[model samples]
Target: MRMALFSLVATVMALGASPAIAQEREQVKLVFEHALPNVEGKRMDAVLVSYPPGSKSLPHRHAASAFIYAYVLSGAIRSQVGNDPTQVYHAGEGFYETPGAHHRISENASDTEPASLLAVFVVDSKDGALTIPDKDATPK
Candidate 1:
């Protein structure tokens, strides 16, 4: 009876540890790259964003930030900002986000292959910060 109880406790502890290890592994996958200041007044950070086919970013805003340059390296992306309709960008094309644009939405195209993009954020380091979505865009 005591051995049985200990076995149950050990199984519970192992199950709990699995989720914590999974979360840590997910946190490790995010990486970013930065560039030197150029003629532009903003600092640049580049990130390789990957989305599983048909995945999307939640509607997010950067009200205090100025510009973002998204360059497609592989696969396709559709982007929507503010009240505008979603727009598609193929491999090799680039899209720019304006200052005070307020919202950005992005998604992958296919369901079989992953989409990849190089996102260059030009930010006013003194005041720049990302604003993630707080509410759902589509009405339920």
Candidate 2:
């Protein structure tokens, strides 16, 4: 009887310890408006990204050869690309991300203010989606 109870407890523990267990998922919501194929079979994807007060996006990268252009639409955002210095951008300002560059930091400039940006990506039509999160990143 005791052995059976131990086996049940072990089973429960194993089930609960699975890496795929449903926990809250971390995500970045990019509001893309349109995508169109252009010359040389490259496509353009236009997106609007919002960072709420105190919110941040994890370090990530784009497709193998995707170029990104980001324009601030409202509030202010702090970002760093690859090994460059971090900068804060306000409304109407813009930045660019080179293909294969590491997006090191992306967050609101202020904890009290929300920020948003329009991101446009130019990539090969068959390159699939634009962004890919860096799974090996360390927490900020």
Candidate 3:
């Protein structure tokens, strides 16, 4: 995770990347709440992801050993992980993502509504590149 932080800092330091970063900052809000070492020598990380109306995420994948559980907190979220059918989840609903599964779709279900979800990841403590964006994956 330190490497991910450093990479983000380095990206912001690059003048050419700052503009893109600013735009991303305006689109999503990610709150890293905690990180704890699990008994099995892995790590558990928790984050709250918030999206504004009409917001969607670019295709990405977590680490090879990262398993994720996401629970909707408000509004509605439409998501497709791996080869699963795209589905809409409302508040109090949830879904799970297996390790390395592609996050194919993640967006607010309504164009006029916002959405939020709590995501918890169980992964190796040493995994630094937690999220890997798929450059070739086009947005739908």
Candidate 4:
């Protein structure tokens, strides 16, 4: 039937579009997670965030109870927390974010080179998600 054929075409087109959307965002992978034996009800989570040349993440926040430390692993990363001025961090440099801080900017500093960072989070064990993108945020 024509209806079934049209539905199949639409589905195929949608599937093809998904990868382009995914390619625009940075990649995040959990590298480690463990309960903090010395800190009651706290857990530590470490994630490696890879940014392809010129890629960036949307405006987002971490768990409300999370305190984060981010260290540049390779290349340079541009970052801004809360209302602070944007700063570019090179490999070996790092920064921290207080609990509930708004991460307004995060991107690769160079268009020709890739970048990466290790983000270590200290958060309550009860927190469900590590990163929460803002509802109204869109990729640039």
Clashes of each: 0, 0, 0, 0
- Candidate 4: tens digits of C-alpha lDDT, residues 39-76: 99999887778787878999999999999988777789
Name the candidate that leads on TM-score: 4
For candidate 4, the TM-score is 0.83
TM-score of model 3 vs. true structure: 0.73
Which lDDT tens digits does candidate 2 get at residues 13-70?
3433112222222223444423453366676666556666666777899988789888
Measured against the true structure, the TM-scores of the candidates, in listed sequence, are 0.64, 0.73, 0.73, 0.83
After the best TM-score superposition of candidate 3, give how far the Cα of residue 57 lies from its true spot, in angstroms.
0.4
lDDT of 1 by residue, 1-140 (tens): 34633453344334331111111001111134243455355565555566666566666676367577766666787888778888888877888788778556677766655566666566776644544454665422
With candidate 1 superimposed using the best TM-score fit, by how many Å does residue 115's alpha carbon deviate from the native?
0.4
- Per-residue error for 130 in candidate 2, Å, reads 1.4
Q: Candidates' lDDT values, in order?
A: 0.57, 0.68, 0.68, 0.80
Q: How much does candidate 2 score in TM-score?
A: 0.73
Worst ten in a row by lDDT for model 2: 17-26
Model 2 accuracy (lDDT, Cα): 0.68
